[model samples]
Target: MEYFSILCILSLSVVTFSETCPKLNVTEPLLFGDKNSNTSYDEDEIISFSCVEERRLVGEQYAVCINGEFYVSQVPDCQEKCVHAECAKRIDGYCNEGGECVCRPGYALFNGSCIDKKSVKTVISLATKWIPDYDHNSSNDFKVLQADICASFDDVFEIFNYTLRCYVSFKKSNQVTIANVINDFTAESIEGPSDVEKAINGAIQLGHTVPGMRYNVTEDTKANSTYLKECDENSDICDDHYGTCNDIGKGNYKCSCIHGTYQSENIKVDGTDCSVAPIKVGLTVGLGIVCGIAVACFIPAYLWFIISPAFGKAEYNTAAAAEVGSTEDEDEDDEEERDHKDDLKRDLEEDEELDKQLIFHQTMIQNMSNFNPMPRVNRDSQSYGVPNSIELSTANSMDNFNHQQSN
Candidate 1:
């Protein structure tokens, strides 16, 4: 009985230890291993998850079965690996590994939308029909028409509250077509249809025609309808030096003249005939004014250069003559002053001589007054006769003295 009881306990323990985890319910993630084939995973069993092409797996890449449950830290998710946000909204488009938007087979990107090649060809044909002058052989014209129609359609559709869609061929095929068209156009130099050229000329001549049918068509179309001519290396229509032949459109050409050259007025000669451009009246007047001003300034400068030295010399001579005159006048004044001083000295000398003579005369008179008639009385009796001689001699001396004094 104890053995049976031990066996039952052992069986219960075995049943309890044998646990399993349920199948994962995550979307977009692919599970790998035998556990995926089964409804439940055994204890300690490992499972891995992965994502499809162009998608990245987010969260845990592996899960472990433990204690009747999967020990997954996080649920796995597959996200689209796209670089451009526009790819999300584009129809039939996906981002490649290089992070560029790619369209499906037979589809191309146009106006931010993926369109089929068939639709693109249809749009091209429609545009050609609408534009009667459209050159089917020219890829450039085709491309221009395509763009115009697409833009017009987009505008019309938007006015009605509708989304605009455009068509474009596969990039490689479109590029090849363009290359072939260019080669063909270069190889052939034949003119376009005469009927079409006539129509173009007629439209140009009328002057009053539909507006905005083609870009710059009215302005580009001349009376001669040169657009119908083909220009190439062999073409001699344009002047070799003054003009250059350029392709305008519709297998036609025109001459572009160099600066200072323009098309000749002769109607018989086309744009190829160039002549020297006439000078403008404004330019001529401006040149004349400039020249006149220059001459006016130059004459004054020349005269100043020629006459200035003469004026300077004349001024120097005048200053020198004035200096000489002043010096002569100063010399004359000095000589006069010396002469006046000599005359004054002579007058003073004369006065001094006269004073000395007067002093001598006064001394003589004083001496005569001091002399006494001393012996006059004593001699009067004794020598009356002799006295008379003495008296006569004294009188004579006195008379001589008086005459000398008066003189």
Candidate 2:
């Protein structure tokens, strides 16, 4: 009896284990079959898998229980689905399960398409000296005020949907109110501040007003609200080399180009990019002008001071040479004149010496003529009357002296 009882107990345990299967573990957004409330399934049972709204099911849709285990060939998945085919064709975006179109960062949905937020024209207005009739401190009252402001814009612009992206209040002298008005359908049609002002006045005419406030479209405040979305989404949008991003207002930014840089031509679409002017071209033009001026000045200066003076000096030297003769010939003539003067001086001295000698000779001849000469006596005087040798000698001497004096 004890052995039979143990055998029965073991058989009951085996049957219980074989009849049950573990529960499936699925993490995706899904809808289950009729037996979804049960934690586990019986043997040979089947469960169906389906995706929730805006999600499409992938892989196997059903799992079957074989023995004590669930058998599935491929795991099921629920992926996001786009219900509207236009969402895929419009831009690089997707439609969420809630049927809302989602665009990439820095982009916003406008006119059923995604576009850069900067390109969307927006208008901002300030209500000065505002005093609301209701309590402004209550959150509910504030929300109602925002809704009323948005409604006013919708009525004025004749747009069914107007989005208010910004609202701010200052706590000075009866509160100041500033609001951003945007209409996706008519954003591109807004011309300028005139259009904005007209719309604001129209809204005021339609009984959208504070107790003692006046609406004025502030053109300078356009940057404060229009670009806030893009700036907040990406603070580092400006390129580092070209410029810096500046937060002009709360959640608003503007890119300021650095010195020596300028806003690029695509500033409408790419506000953060800047470019430098062509420095090479400017430098070349400047150098060319300077060189041209230098050459112009140098040409006149060379002709006036250098070439003119050189020609004048050459002409003067040539005339002087013609008047005075060549330097070497003049020197030779001066030396020859000096030699002629020396020869004349020598001749005068020789003539003076000759005159002195002639005077001495004449004196000697006169003395000789004044002297009486006795005739020579000869021992043989009684001889013949013919002239003796001594007389002839004296006579020859006298004749020679007289001839010399006369000559």
Candidate 3:
């Protein structure tokens, strides 16, 4: 009986001692000291917690095991040790120990941004169209020259909105040789219209060359119709509000929208109205919504209060106002003011025209004053033999007239 009682007491003690602890739950970066096994903890045991690397622990660093459970302080947290800096916005750049932003080499700081100049790229059209005017005798040589010249132009003018045309002629120096050398060359673009020969020489100097005697050439510009100054002056033709006139050629123009704006299908080359596509769509939808609401809410009220009252008062006020017409007692000052405005507008226009005419007259007078009809003769070099009697007499009479005027 005593053995049975001892066994029962031991069983009760084992049951009381084997209490399982609550699961260990810790926020990010904070970890328990014995994280690998956390199923249970013994009563009255000390549980240690710590922060991971680059992190600082907040609140209590140790937890207590009470009643076979870990009582974790809610205030405990693992905060990052390093404070974030504004320079961190640049992903490729880093904040130094002194909190200053630094970028790698070959980069420059602009407006608080680090931009790699070597990695920057620009978009341009490098497509080339080559036109060759070659002699029939050296067709093969002309083809080679055409390819070389086209490549040169592509390299030079890829950055510009310009077209290039090369006029090259090849002549056979020797009948035995199949290859024909360059006889003449010329290249020109919009920027330099009258310097085609010079441009051709420059291109040849840049390693694109054909062996031949160079020819004297006149400068020529490629045909382009994109924008016209005349088109800009006429608002009816090309209004700036819709878009600016881009000269296409032969007094024709197309509307080019401003930066960050686009035109809808309603836009036309000659039309004055240009509607922004997104803005037009937004306005149309907004107007439709507003109209729908107005119809739903205001139509009945308009019919009852406005139309009904207008019908009742129309006859009485209409006849009285028509009979009254206009009165002489009405203020003449308003009319005078309107007339003054019209006069001022006319005067301003006249003044502008007068200013232009004055500038033109001054330019003409200055040009005329610089005119010299005499041939440039070097008086210091030599004098011809004395003139005959008639010339001497004329010189004496001219001298006497000049002396009299001075006196």
Candidate 4:
């Protein structure tokens, strides 16, 4: 029973030890910190994270392993960098993940408060409101329904199935207010509000404004019928903001700044702020300093080795040529000496055997009578009978031969 209980406990321990932690969803890559590959993380094991380029990680950047699970104090959001997209307008704005544009830091929505106070003061002549009088006994006979009222009857009345809604609006000091009414509706000077709405919306999307300009809408007329204020004439807003205004017809203007300039926060400067001035000056100074250093190091060596010799005095040139000629003469003399030595060595080797032969021939010629042209006497026949007193001499033999020749 004790052994069986111990076996059951061991089995339970094996099963518990083998269990792994659940997989955690890490949106950002694990670029730093803990690099353990074992998925079975113990408690308090921290893991760090980072986002891809052009994206910033918001909120907590680390997650801790707790109880076989990743516990994050705060979930991180990898937000896209604002400078990569919609931040080019000089207005503080950013682009979201869904590609929608929103304002960035240090900027709020444009309320009725005008950015160009000077332009508003100089350009705006008057301000008035066209209030709609909803009650009138003569016009009451024909019921006029607003756009909302018409849309409310869409389910009950099938004829109101069209999706478009016409709206009426007024322009005052570069600000716009709009109200929509039903189709086929007509009122005092508000008959062509739909076309005006389209034109105004298009102009606003294009970043143009008809500032301080009044427009009169005629009944049953297109938007072209209304006489809009000239953009160039009402361009005091751009001038006040230190920008250039290009006048598109029909009361539209586009504002812009000069090149190498940008609207920067936290600094007040004239003419778009000239953002690259410091960088340009820094690069120019750095390049000049580098060029000066290079020239200072190289010019002396170049002058010493190449330029001075090329343009030196005639005396110096002659001396140099003499030195070169002397070196060549020495080399030629050494070569001739080597050749002479080689010739002497060859002569000595060829004449060695001839010299020995010449010495032997001279010795034989000097003692001509010493050698005889006769056969040698046989030593074996004389060995048995000749006594030691009989000695043959070459001189005696030569004398005997001479006497015989004379007889």
Candidate 5:
């Protein structure tokens, strides 16, 4: 019997190595991804997988199964429950009796059983009144906030709905009055979430107002959240507020800042948030000083149009004196020119008389020297014969003197 058992073992071993290797079977793969990744199965999602513990690894440490053996390529697999899905590196939660994987941090045990914060939510409600006018003729049921958060709505609303009203207001972040339409106007605005909240806000802002209304929020009950709806991923308000936003109906969320505040912290920081930064108003006197200085700077403009032109009057007076001196000089030059013309006329008349006297002296010398009449002779024709030397000398002297005078 011992020999038969050894022979059977030998046969099984031979068959296992006979031109073949042992076949490998995978018990479904478990995947691991980065904690901060929002990729479920998007193009950017990088996931890696491996077989669970106590299972023979058919591939490498970050390996993924493509066809037969798991390959080592990065893949997407939040559906495969891996140890990386555990909350805060917690080593718990696995595939339970059902086929779906489990996650950590008290997550619901279905599908991939881990809570992704991106998939999480925080629900709030119309604390005092989210609307501008929430109390007109409106009669929608507004449940009261319970004293204890752990109590049921069915149990607490029966006792507290009557005492749950708050003064509605739209106050700015700087605590200034943006809008105040109280009275019956309040009752006209509170409707279901499906109505026009954005349109109402738009109209209010067109008149230079904000939609930040004040309200006294109370828990309907502690056992359950006030709103069971979810917010849309397209909504940045919920993310920007860190999920401390409004879950309108199913998947739409509105970023709800506290009554007297705006978003500075995330959603995790809630009620019991005490203290505030003191409000500041700029100094009006300092502004007045600046404006006063501005007006003072412009004072020189008055001088530019009025007083500065008076300084140029001295230069104008000097120019007027120079113009008067020039006129007097011009008049004196005209008088000198007229006096010289009169002297020239007198000289011309004297020269004309001297020429007539020289001609008479020449005639007398000619007659005495040639054909002598006793004292004077009328000689119209050329009747002068040869003149004596003495007579010719006298006539020549007269002619030379007359030429010198004419010149």
Candidate 6:
């Protein structure tokens, strides 16, 4: 009984090592890992951390001691890194110093995302067609240039009512285009044909790009026959909104010279006097020419017949030629002289006729000031120039309007 009692006392005193013993940390000693919520250590024992259930440690699964105060190895919290509810709150992403989630280069977020994704690429086309008008703004026309459906940020597209059109025509072109109204660009879109070439060159000149003007998609839309409306005489356009002669303000119209044609299509050529007869000009010119020629021929003929006779009578009657004329040879010489005079008159008539023909050739170039080509001027300029002088009464009225109430 005494021996049995003593054995019981020893047994009771030798209770197994404590449960808290595993909780204490030590190093250079055997390491421990708690996988199934039980902390224990053993050599050759493949173990996993409680945090990383599937991750195995081969040689030293975990340090018996958590080494230095600082954590050099994988933190017990490494598993918690991915447990964040939102990617926005994640620290793994290459965010700014702020804890914002940022996608690395060559990537973009889709929705609540920080990921590596391919860059969204888009192709833009610049070829455009549009209705042209001088008085109404063409940029407002629908279906003008190829609009980039993707250029607008998603947020911006959701916010604005974006309806754009390309109104190109034979008259103008904007060489380059951009989001004009969205930024500080101050180019006015007025009720006039925007010089397309000028606008394109201007955008290129400004060198402002990045959030480029996103244009809409372009598709060939053919004209419908039955739905097509004929131009209205009152409207001044092909479809009557504005173009061609119908759109011209009251007395105005557009004119252009096309390839293979010179200003012939719907061009107006005018001279100062419509009622003044063209025949009158030709008649006056012809009559003047005839009179000038007649006077020219008559003076020469008078000098040859009247003046030469006086000289000849004085020379022959001086007795020198008269004394020799009695011989047969002298008579023959006199006859030859007479024949030469006759031939000279024939040559004069021929010369006069030739002069008339030469003058006629020049008539087409000169003498017809009425039919000259008018110097080209901006058609609008000729119609709009202010008269040099206004009536005294009109000037006074204008001065009063400038000073007093316009009404």
Using TM-score, give the best candidate's number.
Answer: 2
Which number leads on lDDT? 2
CA lDDT, every prediction?
0.38, 0.42, 0.35, 0.32, 0.27, 0.29
Q: State which candidate, 3 or 6, has the greater lDDT.
A: 3
lDDT of 2 by residue, 66-112 (tens): 44555432234455644445555754454432333344334444434
lDDT of 5 by residue, 138-215 (tens): 111111111011011112222222111111123232322122211110112223222223333332333221111112
lDDT of 4 by residue, 148-230 (tens): 12222222122222211121122233322222222211122232434434533343232122211122222122222232222
Clashing pairs for predicted structure model 4, backbone only = none
Q: Across residues 1-407, which tens digit of lDDT does each residue of candidate 3 receive? A: 99897656533311233445554555447677666865666653455667888775543344445334443222243444323343346424433222333432223233234443211111111112222333431243343333333333333433333221112223333221111111111111232322333444454443213112111111221211122123432311232454555544422345555543445433222223344434345645665565565455444543454454455356445644565645542234345446655765665565555556555655644554454333212213111111111000111111232343344
lDDT of 6 by residue, 149-206 (tens): 1122211222222111111112223542222111100012211122222333333333
Q: Where is model 5 more than 4 Å wrong at Cα?
A: 1-280, 283-287, 323-407
Q: Residues 1-407, candidate 1, lDDT per residue (tens digit)?
A: 99897656533312223678776554443444444378798765666667766676543345555445544322333455544455547534544333334443223333345543211111011111233223241243434333333333333223223221231221122212211111011112223333323433454344322121222222333322122222442222354446566665553355556665666643222344555566566855765565556555555655655565577557556656666758776576567556755765665565555555555555544554453322111111210011101100111111232343344
The TM-score values for the models, in the order shown, are 0.22, 0.27, 0.18, 0.22, 0.18, 0.22
- State candidate 5's TM-score: 0.18
Q: Poorest 10 consecutive residues of model 2 by lDDT?
A: 385-394
Error of 4 at 107 (Å): 16
Residue pairs with colliding backbones in model 3 are: 225-247, 225-248, 225-249, 226-246, 226-247, 226-248, 227-246, 227-247
Q: Candidate 2 — which pairs collide? A: none
After TM-score superposition, the amount by which residue 316's alpha carbon in candidate 5 deviates from its true location, in angstroms, is 2.3
Model 2 misplacement above 4 A: 1-90, 94-101, 116-138, 159-187, 205-407
- Scanning candidate 5 in windows of ten residues, the lowest lDDT window is 386-395
Instruction: Name the lDDT value of residue 211 in candidate 3.
Output: 15
